[model samples]
Target: MINPVHLRTLVEVVRLGSFAAAATRLGYTASAVSQQMSALERDTGVALFQRSARSVLPTEAAVVMTRHAAKVLTDIDTLMAAAARTHESTSQELRLGIFPSLATYVLPRILQNPAWRKLGIELRVSVAEPGQTIQGLRTGGELDVALVYQVGQSGLAWPHTVNRQWIGDDDFRVVLPAAWGIGPESKVAADHLSDMPWIMHHPGTSDATVIERLFASCNLHPRVVAYSDDFHASLEMAAAGLGAALVPELALLHRPPGVVVLDVPEIRLARNVFALLPKEQLTAQVQLFVELLADTLHKLGTTRRD
Candidate 1:
């Protein structure tokens, strides 16, 4: 293949009309420049110069090659500039993994905030559960940040190298069918709920274990009428009078009309929300995003539903 370096040297030599002068401009010895021109001629199988004892003159072939070489070099420069711009745009993008409830309720608020515009980050979001999001933070994973929550002793683990920051808390609210005569202002005792039909998390899962233990502590063994992992589905089930359900405040943002959220002091538990990042990926933009997300969550948590 013809070398681009050789083409560059040929262009210089033709333009300068002297091997010694081309060498001076290119930071090479005159003999080195002559040797390169010879190699280029061999590669192209065309004579590029007329050599005499005093002068090194460009042939017709040399002049034509130099003209084409200028265009080739310019194209290479343009390609390099385009590649650099692509790299800059990729660097400014943030790959985020978040759970469904937060994505549905909290994320929209953050996006609406005026502060989010100033962060100047292009978000590529993946909506999944906490376990899935944590998996996306492992080595060779696509996510740069994960927003997850932890229920009491409901063990969720990530790589030790991952960095964590406390964002906010999502307190669980006990929701009952309004037809059951439970009012929103009701302060239901845990023991009174012992015989109530309940929609619980699927058995043996991290969340279910914690909730069952909490119920047992209160000496209230709920009769499980249905099992669901999705808080939205659970809320709908409760609204349909299938059973009472414990749902996070985030999920209560759009509570169905037939459900009444109660304040159960005996079941005072909350899922702690956190932001997870790769140790090396904790940039200022990512931190700002987390801060905005936390602020949004706090506002949502305090917003009352009629």
Candidate 2:
């Protein structure tokens, strides 16, 4: 029987045009690739390549073997891809991921559930900034599944390799400096902030863009006092007489003594959250938890999302 490893080395060496190049691509040393070619030739009882100082050229028999070897490699890749698809369609472990805020807020309800534990889910979760999450998916380093927050209608973009489920909606409200005496019972207009200093989200972030557009709609852009990624920092700043900030109502774990949340009059532009998976790795467990998560969010009236 022919050795597939030797055949693979042969194919790589020829396709890549040299042992050195193939070795680099395959993470083998140049000496190792050369030894593999010699061993393969000895096994076949034929010299497969002619070597000179500069390069290696295939022998006539090697030419024919390379052609057939290419087909073998192609078939192997096709078989592996199909096998992966089958596995994804049949898997049971529920590996998971969620954005940091949701990790702290809504995710606990699903993760800590007594009933879900009965499903025998092999639940794994990860928390990180959105940029890190996307990077992880690309490199196969971090998550096989992810729940993320995104702005407008686009949600998160995880390459064509990922499949997404739109899970929930996230909206922000205008916050007033503390001692403004606003409560959940209070209603304030966006126009009310037209004169107040706008404590915007950290610059170069989605929140900044949304906050800018909202204030522009009110025909104003006041001096932005501070920009920070942390909502608590923004809240503290606003409370300290810095400026008004836009804070997400659901994920605000703390309200410093001086800040008040006010409903923006007729305000509606918001981000939607998503559940994501590598298109190549959506195991059955991934599907169940995502569905359960959506259900839980819906039950909590976080269900207004499509």
Candidate 3:
């Protein structure tokens, strides 16, 4: 194989028209540069220079080899640059999974945060609810971390390889249409909801299972008028006076018109949001993001105080 160092020396020597000049630029002795050119010539089995007392001039073959060497060096540099970019993309990228409802509020906050900017990380997000997010963590090599929520002790599956940390709580609130004659600040009693029409989640979903049990535990079951997993749809249904719906405080960040958010002191059904990782170990970016996210959620909760 042709030594790239020798070839490079040859190119410089040819461009400068003197071994002494090339050696000066490369910080090598003139004799060393001459030896490198002589080895290069022996490797190629061709005379590379015509030596005379007046000057050492490049032979036709040497000029041609220099041209080819420049092109080869350029291609090698391009290849090395591409390899470096691929390494950076793999090392500095973060893959995150979150729920659909959270994508609407939390995602933008996480992306736009100054802390996120400082991390110099590229984020790739996948929107899936808790159960699906957990499953993805188990089998999906692409998922590095996840933001998920669980309603008090409700069963969730996980392999022993995962780790969980509580980030914050998203408290559920009673949403009533303006026609309900209830002020937004007024506390609604549990007993009053009995025999009242309500909007609920479809059966078998994680949220629906927890919410159904919550109402059952309170000994209050209302007539179900609509079933939807979409918080926005549920909010719209409640605003249309279709029925009352239970929604998380975060879901109300964009509080739609015609619906009043009320406190249900008799019920406490807050979903505990958590950060789930493949293992307990966290990269600097992930750890910083978790801290910033907790701070953001705390500020949001404080601002929405009833």
Candidate 4:
């Protein structure tokens, strides 16, 4: 069989019109070039060049093969280059595990990075609840990074093999139903909630920490009639007047018709969003994602409040 190298040599010899010139151009001995063309002829069962003492002429078939070989070599070079670039760009996959609370809101905005497409990043986002995310990261299941609300206490005190950064501060303020008559434009305070039933995040979750802080600040025991871990479920329950719960601004991206985000002062009930990544996850792509996520959260903190 004719090697691509040998075929390339045949094409060059045909183009330059001499074995010596093709050899000079290709850094091969003249005799080597002649032997390659002979091998090419033998492989294809057709003589490719007519040899002379001074000039080598192409056989009738050699001219056709030479023309086509030029295009083939060009295509092969292009394919190899593109393949190399693809491999280089996608050398690593970014496995990101996001808390469910964030999967529906802030995470989408981070995906809109102008450079995401260019880098050929394969983003794998796991939308398990917070506990599962931490579990997966700890057990080395598959998370390269995670976005989780900072629980008041760390569960996996395993020296945190990952690097972490606080992304944003989400005020765990109250969410009141539209009919509360708090006025569409008014920011409700904790004191005004004296007559309102309290809606709090599910007991023992990150949001619960903020809720407990709010009650302690008011010096009143909360009448938390209902609680939910699912943000959407908690919001719906709140909309239906189950009770008023504190939800972050990102969760309220598109407000329902009868809801208001009540602002509270020095509300210690705030969840500090954090981006967690394994130390090995600090590749250029993962670093870019972490930066994108942090920037997105900061923007939401400033501009996304309802």
RMSD per prediction, one decimal?
20.7, 17.9, 19.4, 18.3
The best candidate by lDDT is 1
Q: What TM-score does candidate 1 get on C-alpha atoms?
A: 0.69
Winner on TM-score (1 vs 2): 1
lDDT per residue (tens digit) for residues 90-184 in model 3: 55677888887677877787677644564446778899888888877788465888888888777877767877878889899888898889997
Where model 1 places Cα greater than 4 Å from the true spot, the runs are: 1-91
TM-score attained by model 4: 0.65
Q: Across residues 184-253, which tens digit of lDDT does each residue of candidate 4 receive? A: 4575455666656876666665446655765777854567787666667767877876777667666777
Q: State residue 15's C-alpha deviation in candidate 4, in Å.
A: 41
lDDT of 1 at 82: 57
lDDT of 2: 0.63
Model 3 per-residue lDDT at 70: 50
On lDDT, the stronger of 3 and 4 is 3
Displacement of residue 147 (Cα, Å) in model 2 is 1.1
TM-score of 2: 0.62
TM-score pick, better of 1 and 4: 1
Judged by lDDT against the true structure, how good is candidate 3? 0.73
User: How much is the lDDT of residue 146 in candidate 2?
Assistant: 73
Q: What value of lDDT does candidate 4 attain over all alpha carbons?
A: 0.63
lDDT of 2 by residue, 35-72 (tens): 66776667656666656544343321222234434455
Give RMSD (Å) of candidate 3 vs. truth.
Answer: 19.4
